[model samples]
Target: GQQVMQIPQYQHVQEGEDFTTYCNSSTTLSNIQWYKQRPGGHPVFLIQLVKSGEVKKQKRLTFQFGEAKKNSSLHITATQTTDVGTYFCAGSTGGFKTIFGAGTRLFVKA
Candidate 1:
């Protein structure tokens, strides 16, 4: 059986602060996908990594994949009110069933 886990189900930060979220899978994954969803909005794909030790960055945000393909992390620097949303990580175990980690919801205060 495969399972996905995430930390700090919720986070609150003031503007100009920083935030980080982590994701872990119980089994080795073939690929890891990160997504973000704004309030009342659908999940939007952010990035996906298939190779070991892959890292990607978008502006003030950084994403990383574990060497074992069973974990990942997302870090955001200089948070803003517009950065308020829920982040989710999904892992695929070389099959159709993709498991999503418990999302980490972020609240940014102005």
Candidate 2:
């Protein structure tokens, strides 16, 4: 069975600071989907990375895939209060079944 693991379970950052979360899978991942879930809200798709060594960015957020295709990371530049949420990484093996990580909850102090 394939499994995805996310690091730091939780993170607390001051507004204007930087934040990052890591993800790793037991098997090579065909694609990784990132999502953000706010308090009492559903998870919203953030972005997806497919190619090994791929990097994508949205505003102050950056996503990266490892060359080994088994790891990923998300970094946010100058964290803001709006960034407070639980970030999840979902690893898919050729679009069959996607395994979601435990997610890293981020708390931003304004």
Candidate 3:
């Protein structure tokens, strides 16, 4: 069976600080997707990396894919109160049944 795991089940950061979360899978992943869910909000797609050693960035956020395709990471340069949410990683083996990781919950303090 395929499984996706994440680190730091919970994190608390002060405004203007930095935060990082990691994700790993037990099997080779065909593709991986990152999502973020705000407090009392639904999960929204952030980005997806399918190629090995790929790096993508969006403003203050960055995403990296492991060269082996079994791990990934998300980093936020400067934390903000609006950044409070849960980050999740999902893996797909080329079809349905994508496995979602247990998400890293973040709490940003004012």
Best by lDDT: 2
Candidate 2 lDDT over 28-52, as tens digits, reads 9999999999999999999999999
Q: Give me candidate 3's TM-score against the actual structure.
A: 0.97
TM, every model: 0.96, 0.98, 0.97
Tens digits of per-residue lDDT, candidate 3, 12-77, equal: 999999999999999989999999998889999999999999999999999999999999999999
Top TM-score model:
2
Task: Name the regions of candidate 2 deviating beyond 4 angstroms.
Answer: none
Please give the CA lDDT of all the candidate structures.
0.94, 0.97, 0.94
Worst 10 residues of 2 by lDDT: 90-99
Q: Quote model 1's TM-score.
A: 0.96
What is the clash tally of candidate 1?
0
* TM-score ranking of the models: 2, 3, 1
The alpha-carbon lDDT assigned to residue 93 of candidate 2 equals: 87
